[model samples]
Target chain A: MNDVRSINCTQCGAPLELHGGHRTRSLNCAYCGAVMDSHEGYKVVEQFHDTLRPHCPLHIGMQGVLKDVEFTIIGLIQYQTEEGDTWIDLQLYSPTHGYHWLSDEQGHFIFSRRVRDIPKPAHISNFKLKAPVFLGKQRFYLYEQYRAKVQYVEGELTWIAKQGNWLNITEATAPPVCLSYENSVSEEDYYKGHDAHTEKEYYYGEYFFPNDIYQRFSVEKSAQDKPEGIHMAQPYQPGLTAAMGQVGGYFFWVGLLALFVILFMNADEQPRLKYHFNQTELSTPTLIPFKVEDPQKLLEFRISVDRLTNHWVAYEMVVQKEEENVLIVEKEIEFYEGRDSDGYWSEGSREARALFKLPAAGEYSLSVLFDGGSQSTPPPLFVELYEGVVVVRYFLLLMALSLLFYMWKWFHRRSHENRRWEPVTEDEDD
Target chain B: MSTSPYPAYNCAACGGPLTLKFRYTKIITCPHCGAGLFLEDKAVKMRGLESVMADYPSLFSLYENYAYKTQKLTPIGQVRFEYAHGFWDEWWTLMSSGEACWMSVDEGDIAIEQLVTLDKMPFMPDLQVDVEIELLGESLRVTERGSAQCIALKGEIPEVIMIGDNFDYVHLSGAKGRLVTLEVQNGNLFAYEGQWIDPFEVKRL
Candidate 1:
């Protein structure tokens, strides 16, 4: 910390402590509203009476570490737009990094520093809404343009700022980072023309959360203001729900991979039993014997009939182990196709499958009996039984739930971005 | 009689004892009468009385040794220049390696630079803010262009210091904190190239 310098106001004789270094051009006396020229020896350059001191959480000489650099709050200026929207900008000075600004609009804070590099098409008049503005290699979109008048000032500033001094500000943002162009317009310039150029400055700003600001400056919770709306430069903060969604996204891919692996592993297996029968053979109950080697694995019975358009077939089967019925299954296979106004349409399938577990590894006989059909005589059908099949319906269900979870977070982030870029009207600002 | 290791001389105006700390010192102020003196062919000549600067917080003091990063520097002389807005101080420093450099202090901003020869000189009247100029094969943009008058002087300076001498200066900046300062005095041009130094990195020795 540097030593504090004090001087008596030339107008009201009130002692004012200077917190800034030699670059400070003006010091506004809080006691008498006298703007003193710091460069030319504390002379009263301008005076404004009855100017109310604006409320600010941080005071002059308050030092804090921002972005690993120690800075002291040297000055504060409050600005109000014609529509009554107000914000406060604090001038921060560091011995090494020089001067910067901390802007407080409502509860949001943005840290900005003057940049020497000029942006292409330096003036705001050449800018369009949402058009890309290039500063060096980085690109930004125009965010807002407004004219604000200085309402109050205290401590010291790099430039002389009198009350009612108007400034035209143009802001462009690329999320969490923004570029600002400020043109100071005095009353004389305004009377001359709106395009009269005065002092032009460019600043690059980064958004800071309210909590981060409070914690950085060690301000009390009571002094903190509640954030009302989304700040233009505020980056999307993924909350706990969004984190969960990201985790779900990972799981969704894992579930799909697991389903693929199961299908790949089951691809080379040969059926344990294969049976062919005609419609005449199924007129009565026919027995087909098959031996099950592994009772722990699941058994799949697949039945398919020859192509029979606009026809259907149904059958019932009983699995018996040593004359004792272990499982009874019923299935139907139907194929129907026709042309519609939109396109060719098809319904049903020619194949049906059933899954079951055998009680023991033993010889089992399947008794097949024709139940019903579209015709008096059913078509010939083929039956195949396989073991060690895996169910993929559970994996599909898991994937569906995971995708929904992730989409929830994605939509939330999208909405936040939408609100951040939403245009503000005069009524909305009020 | 003097115990100083460097060459010692008598002030031209006051006949006070003076010592040249650096090999390239061209001008110095007499301690007794504050008269600015210049050295020509082993003879000291009087220039004029230098104005004293108002006291303020500064990072460097005349004839004070300081450590900046890995290099040790001693500020032998200081020249204060008053511009339209404010004034800045340029300290002619003697480094441990026997090299002389200039440390410019404007507000809290500081830079250490040494004189460098450029292949092409920029036209003084054509220079403006945001204009790009090539210096030592590097493209630099003019960040500031202004004229300043010397307000005060102290200690030994490598360049001739005349009180109230005005010079137009242009500050050009490039990538990675590179700084190039171009000063036009009378009709001659001087250029210095260096990087901006952080004041916090300097420690008094």
Candidate 2:
């Protein structure tokens, strides 16, 4: 289908190459500023004496592969908004995919195509900022509205595009994807028997990075434009650091699961030994012996006194592991109860416990001596030893470290999204 | 040069030799004189003179065999219609399996369609853009509604086609490239159920 046909410019007699298909309506001469009607045997429809060529990287007849489809650049239209901001749109045509547009503004590129599925509400005039618009199953928010006038026209177009023709464009974005509604009122409808109606069209666009366009079209490195600021439709690209953050998120869940497993496995409620000492033997030290099975797990030693109301008991104990002093501590267990105006209240505990890990799985002895109490005579003291307790503080520290990675990724994504909507927020504030 | 297996005839208007590529062909235009001829009870009769279609680079040509994916299609006749914005060509094609279908070409957009009969007729006046309708168990949305006139005709056609006849048409689109086109002409409605075909996949044989 790439049968290259050439024709001389109707006005300047300069040679021109035709690359567009049968649907091409008009051709604007690049060498001589004359617009010819392509349908009517290349008749000169209008002419612009002095038109300055716009700066664009892509030229007519240049072929490139976009989305696995090979398309040729057939036309170029430069448009300027009322604020004097200008952008270039290159018309692309493929034998199978029909026509598409590649737009360049502020060094950012977007590939767009006319879509037949109409957006909800259909008209741009009914659009409100941040309002939801549905196109098929996808939902988009109204982003921006602007009027752009044609500043320069070159090559062949499907419609008779001339200089100064304007279009009112309303854009709605769902990030990386944008839906635009374009409305134009043309004086020349060009049909034989139809009333002139305002032309309304919808286009679906996807944001393309500068490098992607340059690589696809084989554009020179020097011709690549540096992208400035953030585009409204640009999706955030995660870097290596953010990827590590995702790994951290997985580690956090794994660490939590490990903590729960340790807790469940170490939940041993049976004590190794329970011993009691009478008041007569309280003056002398009593030795209680227990056997340790797992040295990696913690051992708990509990001392308690019975029937010691509004009084306290003092005890001195030493834990020995096979003649080696593993631990030595002095602890007091006190209980105080009184009837107040509000209700019965209690203070302190009747028991105290100390935890320690043994060096080896062998015999461990707890020697306890009851010192004194408020009753002048000390109550009977009971000593209990329990093995296989879990240390929960260590697991908490590990989980906190793993969570930092997930938080890092979350912050980066949030920052990128915030910047994308900054302009919309500013407009709302105004 | 009539090596085709189908029946052949002579043009009643210009005495030019004509060939039928399909069995159900009722109208065949003389390639020499561009005359629209009707086949009635094994007799050829002059219907009208078809206008010469302008030469354009198209994916298919009259009586040309093409391969669309795994299916081989041979275009037997073509009818061009002028709509509000532009014109599209409907090529009546016969498949390798001996089944006949219509391939509609508008610029680069192409669709392979087959005529279907509906149990109930739809009210054309009630149809509007974006309206949902069910046909042949599939739901479709009306995408476009307009009127078109038959400006050119050529080769063999299954039904009567008159030049300068205007017909109201509606295009409905469904999921996964499904399309249904409805045409109303002279108080008669015709339905075509089809799927959109990629032009690049169609290769000339």
Among these predicted structures, which one has the highest DockQ?
1
Best by TM-score: 1
RMSD of each: 9.5, 10.5
Candidate 1, clashing residue pairs?
none
DockQ by candidate, in order: 0.18, 0.17
In terms of lDDT, the best-performing candidate is 1
Please, what are the lDDT tens digits per residue for candidate 2 over residues A54-98?
877777888888877778888998888877889999988875567
Clashing pairs in 2: none
Candidate 1 chain B lowest-lDDT run of ten: B48-57
- Give the total clashing residue pairs for model 1: 0
lDDT tens readout by residue for model 2, B35-140 = 7789987799988555777776577888788998789999988899997667889999999987889999886788899989989878887789988888779888
lDDT of 1: 0.84
lDDT of each: 0.84, 0.81
For candidate 1, the docking band is incorrect
Tens digits of per-residue lDDT for model 1 on A337-356? 99989989888999999999
